[model samples]
Target chain A: MIPHDEGNGTSKPHAPRIGVVFGHPSRQYAPGEELVVRYDVEGVELPAIRAMERTVVWYTEGKGEEDLGVHRFERIDDLAGLAEALPHGTITACLPASPLSYEGVIVKIRWCVRIRLFFVAGRDFVSEHVFEIGAIAPARGVVERVQ
Target chain B: MRLPPFFGKKRGHRRTGSQAWGSFGEAVFYAALVAAGLCFAGLLLTGAVGIGPESAAPGWMRGWLWIFIWLIPGALLAFGVAGVARTVRDWGKSEERRAAAEGLGTLLESMGQSPAAQHPFPGVPACDDLVNSPGTILRYRLPIESPESWTLVGMGLFAGLWNAVLVVLAVSAGIDIASGRIEWVLLAVLVPFVLIGVTGIVIFIRRLVLTTAVGTTQLEICDHPLLPESSYDVLLAQSGSGMLRSLVLTLEIEEMASFRQGTDTRTERVIVWRDIVKEWTNLEITPGVRFETHVTVAIPAGAMHSFGSGHNAVRWRLVVRGQPERWPGFVRVFPVVVHPAPPAESAAVRHGATADGVPG
Candidate 1:
């Protein structure tokens, strides 16, 4: 549930929103295992041009210089779903043997699935949601809500 | 290219730390120089020209005395000067002598050279004073543990008190001279005081310079989850003000092996792979300028991927060192992760391609 607006109660403008979720809601996977990704685009004009792409990458966020590695990139173009539709489908791909996510005093490695929407007039938006790969997996699925 | 593991059991190089023998040798050599200078001054003060009154000595004896007096002081002065010159020429040349001479050599080189050429940032002037140096501003300091710690502790107190005493004596002498109560002959007696004051001032300046001359560096990689046999771009940057004698960037992949030692578990870091990625020498940096370079590092295809569990792991890191001419150099490490290359696909097994020829 969204929190109540601050005092004075002037609501902010509604902007386009997109949501992404894994098929199994699993935040962890192993090498050579197939996993599915699902996406939802909402709150925008119907028949809007968009591209849905899947990417596997590792990145750093602290201390030393930031680094990134792209493991996979697959794009689905002409995503012509209606505004009320969730536009959800299963995307299957095998995981590559990789640097497991790690956190250290001077370094941090994060793995994530990022969706970027490119619109006219240079109004491109990017959102990154992190996941895990390797033997270490969380005990429960992490539920991420879309606005 | 596929290669064996870069991590190994042997240590690669000695980067920092003091050596006992080198320090002792330096102390002895410096003492010898001081002794020679003092002896030469002593001989001159005792009247090196004529041993006695004009008629009190034979002509041959007087000539011999003149030779002894001049020869002793001349030989001593020559020895001291030659020793200093040799030291300057051989500065930071050997590994064994590297640590002890590291601080002094850098400090002297920066003090001697003019300001660095280009600024790191545009429109900002280079630093002309140590107090406003870039290195000092970029790096954090801990109390009493810096490279100059020992030198400061050794001479700081004595130099401060000695300078104070010299100031007091000079002021008193000046008052007496202005009042016309002191003889000009007594003014000659201040020569020893002047020498002592000079020594105190030099030591005090050295302590200040050393305290302000330490440098810091950083490394940024363009990509992470690095793949074997893939080239990754990297940026190396260093911060310091003054003359930089050398800067070296090294990429090291170490194997962290864990084993049972008696009842305890022990982990040992062995550097199995090492490479010198880049080096820059004879650079001058001002306050607005920093040392930065771009380089690429390739991971071997056969190299092991980074792994971590309850017991063992393999790790990779980039090490950057900045050796300033007259200040303390620094070494910084940036850790990285390596991933194994994906398995090659077979001829007929296309996973996601449809008849329309589009990727899923």
Candidate 2:
């Protein structure tokens, strides 16, 4: 998902609100495991949504420019599809083996499921839910040692 | 109760218009500079400005002054053109990105289809180039991180340019001396240029000799994109004339992080883990023949996979440190990637085991 500061516009009061919940309560997953997500939209009518995008992506966060990869993506624009996905929906995808979640001193990798609601006004609202992808230990601070 | 739009506090979530305004302002500033440069050049060309040989200055002085005076408008024109070109390029890129975003939205909405799959390893570097070059014994040859030939060429170029400048100054001084007029200032300038030129030449020659004597180190691996908990054979080839000291090969994991501090960006790298793969002491390499050795590299089961992003990386490399007799030591690095281990079930299947943990 694009960061708010980098995106083009802001969410308005009447904008649709998205709520996402993962299948696992712990929100931690192993590599090559299936990830299931359920989402619900509220505070706006289905007609206001020009399109809806669901994506499972991992992004880098820290001192560097953000890099991201989409593992799964789906778009629903038809009225019938929107009707089914508006109030409630579910998405499932088998995660890839690489780029496990990492928490480092200066670099961190995070996985999230974003449900973006694109309104007719050319603005998008992205709701992200963070999850873990691996059990790798977090990297510690720099330690000076002579070679 | 909902607050009115006018009185509502603007949350940081909204994208700011400052970037657009900044780009527009930059374009305008560069456009103005271009206009000013053109106007100045036109005035000079039309003889509106009184900078010409018509003045009482000497002929040679006037010629030099004319060139010096034109440099102002030349620099302005160059900077203006470059800035304008950069602005146009940036504008085109932004437009392309905007169009792509809009097009993807429209296309997906109309077709109701998913986009293409992303790269398997998002942040990892591609190993296509590394695997493309076939090795003699091993399957793949790992390219060096930084080749010594490039450094030799750079040093040679610097020495050549510096000596060229020194020769020009010496020729001018020689002409003055032959004409029975010793230009003290020219001679004074030539002295420093001569010293610097000689120093540069000496440095370049020393580096060339060292590079030749230390020779080249090549590493070849049995496979590409290694996996954890696996062992692979590696070939180390060392070629040089005289190497009497020691040669060490080590497998190291390094973490690099870059952060911008004010105007400058500083990068820091640390070797988080290292293990000595092999070491050879008191080895002599004959001329025109390479010393070859085979070693096994075993990756730790819990090793972190190679990772790379915009400004941060976790890299694995095989470093060859050679200490030569009568020459400074040199280090050559061969980068390698370690991928995450396959899933347990898949690994079991590869080992010819069924899902019930029985041999199939």
- Candidate 1 at B320: error in angstroms? 0.6
Candidate 1 residue spans exceeding 4 A from truth = A1-147, B1-212, B258-266, B345-360
For candidate 1, the TM-score of chain A alone versus the native chain A is 0.67
lDDT score of residue A73 within candidate 2: 71
Query: Candidate 1: lDDT over CA atoms?
Result: 0.52
Best by TM-score: 2
What is candidate 2's lDDT per residue for B1-360, written digit by digit as tens?
222232333343333443345566788888888888888889889999846656988888887887887887888888888998877767623222333354466456646534443335545666666787889998888998765668889989999999998888888889889999999988888888888899999989998888877778899988878766666789999998775599999987777777777899877777766778899999999998999999877776656788886677888889998888878888888999877766672323222111221110
Residues B1-360 of candidate 1 have per-residue lDDT tens digits of: 223233323121111222223433665685587587777778667766347666578889878877786777677667776766666556423221222244345457567566663222111122222112123222211111133445566677777777787778778889998997986655676778778778877977766675556444555554444555566566666666888788777766554444566787655555655668778898787776777776766665444455543333446667666677766665555566555545452222122211121110
Task: State the lDDT of candidate 2 residue by residue for A69-95, as single tens digits.
Answer: 667777788999988888799989998
Which TM-score values does chain B get in all models?
0.37, 0.68
lDDT of each: 0.52, 0.74
Off by over 4 Å in 2: A1-18, A30-33, A41-53, A72-87, A116-125, A134-147, B1-120, B147-149, B241-245, B257-267, B282-290, B344-360
Model 1, position B25: C-alpha lDDT score: 60
Per-candidate DockQ values are 0.02, 0.28
